[model samples]
Target chain A: MEILGYITLTIFVGAMVLMLFRKLNFPVQTVLVVVSLICLVLGAVFRFFSEGWVGVILLPNEMIGGIILHPITALLAGLFLAGALTASGGFDVLKVLINKLQKTPIGLAGTLVILIQLPVIASLPCGRIIAAALLPLLFAFGFEGGMGLLTRSQLIVLIGAFARNAFGSCGPSPIGGVGQIGEGFLGAFFPTASEGMLRAPQAFSLMLGTALTALFLKLITMKLYPEGVSLRDLPEGSVIEKKKAEAKGSFKGYLSLVIFVAALLISIFQPFGKMPVQTILVAGGILMLFMCRVSIRDLMSGIILLPVTAMASGFMAAGALASTGGFEALGNILKGFSSVPFLGVAGMLAIFVQIQTILPLACSRILTAALVPVLYFFGPAKFDLITWPQLAIVMAAYMINATTSCGPSPLGGGGMMAEGTMRADTGYIKGAFTFSSMAIMAPLAAIYMKFLTLSSFSASGVQLGRDVWLIIEFTLVIFVANAIIIKLSSKVLSEDVDKNWLSQLPAFVIPGAMGGAILAFCLYEMAFLRIIQGAIGGIIASLLIALMVPKRLTPAETGE
Target chain B: MDCGTTEWLTFLFLMAFYLSVEIYQVLRRKEGEIISFAGPDIPLGDLLGTRANVRMKDGEVVDAEMSGCTLCLGRFEVGDRVYVCKNRDKYVVSLPLFMKGRRKRSDFCKSSCRREQASIQGL
Candidate 1:
């Protein structure tokens, strides 16, 4: 039975990889669906051999219902919202805003930082929509005075910015795709824990880690491509010359943006009992469609562009794995390592990180779903050392690491879009970005977990000991190892390194303010009203900044 | 049951096998040489042969003639160096554009071409 489970699991993973790489030369959705069907058949056959025909019949539906439906519904709703936003020309407003920020090097740097931070602020269906929208603008920076090649520094900055946003978006927001998936799985495994207990600390930790990573990458970009010599300072060329004048500001676009923001805020605050995020998003999307006068045909077309079918199939595959006792087999295997002295936990974490890095897209949600159950089954009572909350912290860290690491995979969602946009060597970017992110994020996640655990204990008046200290020590060792690995890898990967100091002031100010607002909400137990007031203050400040910029005249009005 | 010696051996063997395969893949990859061409000197169509499907701006499929590269339609002269994909089967890019300090060959001729393909495919 164990062997059969392992075989089924292997088949699923193998098929996913082969399909993802297009080694089979078939449509990815078709491949995923076909593989899922095969797994179901194998699972049924195994069940028949082990139990009976009744077992075979009942298990598949139960698995699908229990594991797949909730996440799939949430994902589909998020995709629908993204579709509606695109159709309503909300993305065009974003493009216009990005273009407006390109007047100076400082402005361009600030815009890049803003683009990195947007996903956390406004959670979308994965980072694909944002990547598809913003990456072209980054690509536009590659051309200047007929010199079209992107400098190494420019490429690194663009890739890093996109990667940070793509990875960080999901773990920070409960409404985000990975967030929904993680929270759903965590809720199922640890039903007693409050949603805030599980999600809030994790979200805060991930946000802080991501913010620091983004700032570091931004600084590196600035140093390498100094303000004076940066791509923005290059001579004006055909790319800029061909830039279309911004369309007249439409009330529909503004109204759509407002509606979307309002819906997100309401969902977050939930003044009236726990309303489903999907319900709010769907309502907001419909309102936007009505305001923008968008047709159903256009909306459908936009939705079809998203990877909804692929993600659904991924969920099904994960469900099938869970049903077949494959997760149990996996846990049994890892249980051996856990028994080893000192290195046991570190070994397990290393393996998880490696797996996450290697098979990012599929593992992003699937691994989290599979592992949480294993943790619940084997934790505290079985291990007798680590508490449930400690296990939860580890799960949170894994979720952040797994989902975010997918952003740099050349064959995965955000990375594929970025490769298409940049038309550059993605192999180097994949390696460099993944390693660099891991080096920072792994330790940062550990530290955040420590902070969360310690703070909670302090508040509750409890004593903690050697186990927590051991984990921290292990994390520091891993961090040092990662730094060494990065240093060695850099020798071979070879990026241009230079030094300059010109602070991207606007870049720092906005993310800092946003972070401060969220932290205040978290620490002081501030009301949603306070958060709303801060948001309104931000909007006014933005309006004032907009007022200062010289507006471009319409082509007809200018007699072009 | 506790994880026995057999299970441990199987796990170690599997890990070693996976590691070896990954190492082999990295080592086995062929690195393409960057060569120069100028003024219609490089026969990109001939070199690419049936691998490339050239298309025009209006979504028309064109012949893979010695006119220029399908993506940019920029005529290459002798002494103009260009990068080509080491593993040509892996990428849609036939003749890669020139890039400084580029180690791995790009999968597209230009950024616009890649973007156009993505937009059309709705990727």
Candidate 2:
């Protein structure tokens, strides 16, 4: 049975790789469904004498239902809201705001800063929508020299940097799908910590990791594209035209945007009763549809626009993997390395990250849900060798990596959107983005976890030294190693450089200092209210910016 | 055998079969040629609306001006072939076309569509 588990696991992994590389052209839903049915039939056949075919069939059905209900349902609601907003031209408001930024006196670097910061600050649950809206503006910035003094390659780097930052930060949003999934898994596994207690710290840790990774990637982009490349560098007619129009959004569109913002704030702060994020989203979407005069039929059609079945099947596969003892078998194998602490933990995280990256079907949420339990069950609990904080570091690493690692694969989700919108080569983007993400994220995760642990210990009046020192040392070593790796890799993979190596000094120092300050605040004084306040403040600031833009440039006129 | 062991063995067999099917599909494909099935005539309304009733047949699709799949609602590019289901009055933009792949024919857009078709056929 154990050997059989291993074989099944190998085949599953192989199938995922084939799909990712486009060697398998079948729909992902088809592949997953087939795999799942086969597993069910085989299980039934094997257990016929004991449990009978009826039991086997019913079990798998129940498992599928369980997998689909909570996270997938929530995700569907989010997707529906995103669709409605897009249909109602809510995103056009942001596009107009971004366009107006081009006219601002902020230099190329400052414009680049706003571009990078916009998505991170907006932190909308639907990443693809955000990417779809912004990618063209980024391109326009590159081609029309919106990055004022910065060269073309710097623009690409900045885009990549923002992509990494925006996607990684999803795990922290209190009202986002990824955040709900991460929190669900965390609460399930660590019963002692209430969801509320874990929410703020998890959000802070994930956000800090993202900020640090963004800073590192920015520096690397500077080195890699010392001479910048621009849209003109590409063959003529290759650049995709901006999908949204240049006119200011309509009054209704602006109102819809405001409602969406208000909904997110109300969901997060819960000034009234505790409303589910999905409920808020659904209400906002309906209100937007009515206000924007979109037909109900169109809204329903928009809801089904996303590949919900494909994602649901992916979750089903995760459930199957768990039910079949694949996770337990892998966990048992990993247990041997736990005695060595760093090697075991790091190895497991690496495997999880690799699996999440290659397996288009294994979404981060389901993957985390399946694997974290296995870790808790098989970890070094007997000796009490690993502290909860250390385990948190591991969980944080997995959570951060699982969310961001999918950015490079052109399979589905953000990767497909990024490739389609940016017109960049998926293969090249995958390699550079994944490598840069791991280099920055892995160490930053350790540092953030260490800070979290120390803060907790200090609050409890407990002295901590050995574990903290070890983590700090590990972080420094990992940081240096990744820096060396990136520097060398850039040399071999460097693209065309057009501009003089203008100082990325201001760009680097300012963002770095700001990110450091934010991380410091999060570590010491962060609270749920503070996070909500920040979100509300960011929304108001964005709305104020939108109001300043001329109405003529909105997407309604431009046929977005 | 224990229930757990029985479950594991069943999963393994299923995975093996799935792997074999995938390998066979890969080996059987004709290299360097895009495979597209000729679909039946689907009205423009059916293609644009949420519900479609077009089916795939040997004949060329006529009077079915290309558009997004009724099921998935994704935009279709020029030269992209789609799956037309006649009995169910549904049309799905082929997965290959949707993902911009070079190979494979227009079938159900995804597994759910295939399953829906099967149920409609009382399979």
Worst lDDT run of 10 residues, candidate 2 chain A, spans: A548-557
DockQ of structure 2 = 0.03
Q: Rate the local accuracy (lDDT) of all candidates.
A: 0.45, 0.44
The residue pairs that clash in candidate 1, if any, are: B36-B81, B37-B77, B37-B80, B38-B77, B38-B78, B39-B76, B39-B77, B39-B78, B40-B76
- Candidate 2, residue A435: Cα displacement in angstroms equals 2.5
User: Which candidate leads the pack in TM-score?
Assistant: 2
- The per-model DockQ list reads 0.03, 0.03
The numbered model that scores best in lDDT is 1
Residue-pair clashes per candidate:
9, 23
Across A498-550, the per-residue lDDT of candidate 1 in tens digits comes to 10111222322242233223322322235564444333333332232222111
Fnat, model 2, is 0.01
**Over 4 Å off, model 2:** A1-4, A21-23, A53-58, A65-68, A101-108, A144-150, A189-230, A233-245, A302-307, A336-342, A345-373, A379-389, A410-424, A453-560, B1-123
